[model samples]
Target: MEVCFVVGRNGAGKSQYLIDQAKGNNQDSLYLCNTVHDRSQELKTSKRFSVKNTGSHPNNVMKSVIKKMMREGTHRLHQIEKILLYCGYASHITVTMRAGKIDSRLDDFSDTSSIKKLTEMIDNYFNGEDEISFNVNFGETSDISSLSKLENLLHQEKPLRHYGMVKAIEISLYKNNGEPVPLLNASSGELSLMTSLIFVLGEISGTNMILIDEPENSLHPRWQREYTSMLCSLIEYHEVKVIIATHSPLIVTGAQLDERVSSSIYHPATGNLEFSSSTNIEELLWGQFEIISPKSRFLSEKLAEKLEELSAHKVSLNQSIEFIDSASKASFDDGQQDIFIAARQLADSIARG
Candidate 1:
């Protein structure tokens, strides 16, 4: 009721959809999409929503914008040009006029401030001083009264101040007596996942539209699919709406493969994104994606080099130096050429990517 996922592939317009949805005709709610408001070409007609990427790079607009700027010279900003496209790991965030303002914690996506490049921004505001006034805490509860330290400080009538929250994350706890045990140390995957949780936890007003782009970043295969289910559950139980842009089959599977979940997906094509729906979200995501033609697949350079060496060395392999010598070997020219062509193609393709 409150949330709907705008699912699609990279560059397939998921971000634009969220912006438009957030900016509904009345435009009375807060909107957040880190950088899309500023980086997207649809900025003006985009209905003007607020967005932010907690894991933003020290730079703005993601790398794609930078590359475009380098090429386009002084073109209108993506937010203005409607040419903004996603590049992996871009920091973005925006917000438009909201009724009164929603919870602010929805911005957490990764260890953004910890990035050295971000230090300057966090320290100095537009006024060139540490004018920041907000709490970045490890606790999830909006009311600080529940936190031990915050409680103590409030009881003592002392000031409560927050510098920044670091790489804190969520973990499933197995109760040992009364205390909770951590699942494991953090990995990049865990960081990405926890950040997503942190983002949603902040904005959970029940029956709100929550959107995400590429919710599969940095997660393991298991986490990838589970994360999709997690988002779906959030939408269903809380009456929230969600939209996502992604390239992961695991995530696409979440929508298409899960009977318990309702989802839709989009893929990139020549002009626009092609859209599809599946009650079986998982099956759809895990669609029969196999190499139909073995030759169509590329090999790694290491494998190719090994093949080339073997092919050039004639009598297969032997303990004798006579059979294994590279320069001194007299081998079949045809087989050597064949291996060389395949290996070269593989090497070149890999290099291009």
Candidate 2:
């Protein structure tokens, strides 16, 4: 299981490349998306193709192609390799694309007794009228439109019992009377946390490679740290291959806070993959108070502009103030103010030269 992150700017062709790889070589590929009607998740919606030599016939809907895939066969060895594609999809569907291959038939995937039990389970769930409810422990919302109340809620010390679009979830756990909790009660960050926690726990238990993209999207900086810590713990305990893609500075900062995470982010630049940061990048990113430091390439251009301005023969107090303000805003470290002060004091030297 080789887990890797492929990151680039939007429209960088990264997702298309990954899709092609999944299409070319995979028994099953699961694509989970949060948005409905997203074009990215558009793949084979039906399982048939048609052509006409010449005729007035409009063509058929190809329901048989779809039905064949839906119909399960009997042998484990003869079982069709499934490609599970999902987008804004809660239900799972498996598909197989074979080119007139007749050997792809099944007759013994399970024993008669096992098949009977499976059939019973499916029929009972799908055809039966009776239902069973599970107990859910979500609390009620007190403030729906009060800003002050919402602000105060944000200050809560403990994690919400069940948060973020939770009420909207298909929770088996419900009240005795069967009313579920409402989704509005949870904040975006709370929902993000809940989803991450559930996903890490529920899925990826037996996955070959687990991939998370821009996981810091809806999370607060603090929760980013918390989630990173939780992920580290899970990866260690499970010994699974994990890869995360993020453009958040907070994610990098969070990983730097922990001693266990070692992988770095790689981004595609000009069709060549560039290493944005290894484990060593952050340690060297914020170091050195001096602008002349070798690692301070990003700040070098700004520093040069400041220095060139100071070397002129006509400088003033107002100019000094503006320079200091700009430098402070573009600060690399604590010594930023000191550099501005140095320029201010040397105004006479600059004016003389």
Candidate 3:
């Protein structure tokens, strides 16, 4: 369970790094990316799988299943049921809903037959006895040990509910008291955590390598701090190597704590990759990650210069205040405003002493 992290700014070839790693290990790699453009085209022999493409295709197998179901006449609910059946093998099974088509096709079922049928189909597909079973095998044959391992991994987290009868196959988290809430209703951090975990647990097995681009997307600082631990738990259960691309300092800090995890910082300007062991978020940000804004960096340098000059001379209180005020105003970046203000207060205190 080796975990290697790639940290860099946007356009630093982080995605390409994953692609290169995947290509090098072609036969056993799985790429899960969120980019709009298909990066899978670059993979000569590796496999690409994402939430969008998982079990979503009109292949011969699916077409045959749909054709057999459609022979029972044009019932919209029946069509949806067949699609779910085809996707049943996937861990993240879902049905696609087009409102215009639904309104047009099910117009005849005005007595709410459409709603009833849709509900019934969802219940049958997901709520049945075998629906929650982790018997799926991406390549290796399913075994009792593997199924138990997956089941235990899923159970360790909050149970997720399937919003199967709606627009698409959506997942919702269960509240402490066992009430299910929609994914939209959850906080951005919670959603990010759940989505990443599910994606890993659902696809990690049966693959030799897992590549994730920006696992920190939509995560809060606290959630970002926990991301690596969550990832490590999943990786521990499988014989897989994981590579992640991220810009989060929390993730870098998390990587520093684990000896099994390796961290690499990509410098876009120099086109170089360097190993990082810094646990301080500021060092990770300004040094390795280079995430500082130009405006902020300039203002910080100016403030430091002013402070050094003040320390060397007995500047008047009025002069010190004036310098601080001018520097504060010059620091136009919102993120650095607080730092400038703090520097001003410190300067004022020194002048008074």
Candidate 4:
């Protein structure tokens, strides 16, 4: 799989470029974008091109994936676990068979007993239920059995289906301490990123081109740093080309470490695309994104004004340097205090002149 990152600022036409790619490409493609109701409905009508409206109510996507898992099989266990681990907000997960109220935690089943507790529970209580619903809960100690293991253990009494038919699913979340985390809270950047992966892994395959716009949206700085690599690791085996659009420097750094990944910068003003060959984050941020000063913009602006004051003799060079030093210790500097060092150099140059 080839992963290309489209790096640019907001209003850069990155999303529009993705839409155009889907429209122009002959191959089957999936465009994942922010949901604009009328726009999404119109795009959904295309046959070869599939559109997923994300960003607005992303939990709906996860609910659909969970329901699909219940209907199909539990083979997606590894994928689900990986997402939970990556998100780091929860430690474990519980999936309840909502209709039958059957909770299958593998720990509840013992090796000494030939039959598991869940199978016994189903046989004794949930038999003859026509429809089943699975409720997913995070942070609960739920060691769900794999489909094969469950089938082997349950087959002694009856086929797994004899208990109930798969129908619907509800998803819940919690903190590591087992306190419930609201569903709305779970629909954060972590969930958004996980939802994108689940959507792609669950539905996309077979040489499809995947277009994901701003996967870094609302992600923490740490998550942004890990997002690209995490995504590439999951989808590497699939025969697909992925194009992700983002303005995050942390995301750009991830692509730099991977040899297989490629990137380009979209100049929204000129409508030009520049292929990015540099592996350095500083260079990429400055050269490609035109972010000449990758420092706190407010701090940078303040420093610039102070430099102007120094040039105008309103402040001495030492006073300017002291000002820079003071600003360096100030809050909202965003770890780019090195701007002070540069300002000190400029002040020294002014003094020499």
TM-score of each: 0.39, 0.44, 0.49, 0.60
Residues 54-109, candidate 4: write the lDDT tens digits: 32344556555554554565655456666766776464443333333333543454
Error of 1 at 13 (Å): 3.7
Best by lDDT: 4
Ranking by TM-score: 4, 3, 2, 1
Off by over 4 Å in 2: 1-8, 13-184, 271-353
* Poorly placed runs, candidate 3 (over 4 Å): 35-38, 44-173, 182-192, 237-239, 268-271, 279-282, 288-353
Query: Which residue pairs collide in model 4, if any?
Result: none
Q: Candidate 4, 295: how far from true, in Å?
A: 13
Q: Give the C-alpha miss distance for residue 176 in model 2, angstroms.
A: 21
Model 2 C-alpha lDDT per residue in residues 257-353, reported as the tens digit of each score: 5666654444444444333443234422332111122233444445445556666524454665575566456454675567656655665455566
lDDT of each: 0.37, 0.37, 0.51, 0.57
Candidate 1 Cα misplacement greater than 4 A, ranges: 1-12, 25-185, 266-353
lDDT, residue 231, candidate 4: 74
Candidate 4 residues lying further than 4 Å off, grouped into runs, are: 7-10, 34-40, 45-60, 67-73, 89-92, 95-169, 174-187, 268-271, 279-281, 287-343, 350-353
Cα lDDT of model 3 by residue, 96-139, tens digit: 22111123434445656645655454454344432333323222
Give the true-structure RMSD of model 1: 19.0
* Worst ten in a row by lDDT for model 3: 92-101
Q: Residue 187 lDDT in model 4?
A: 52
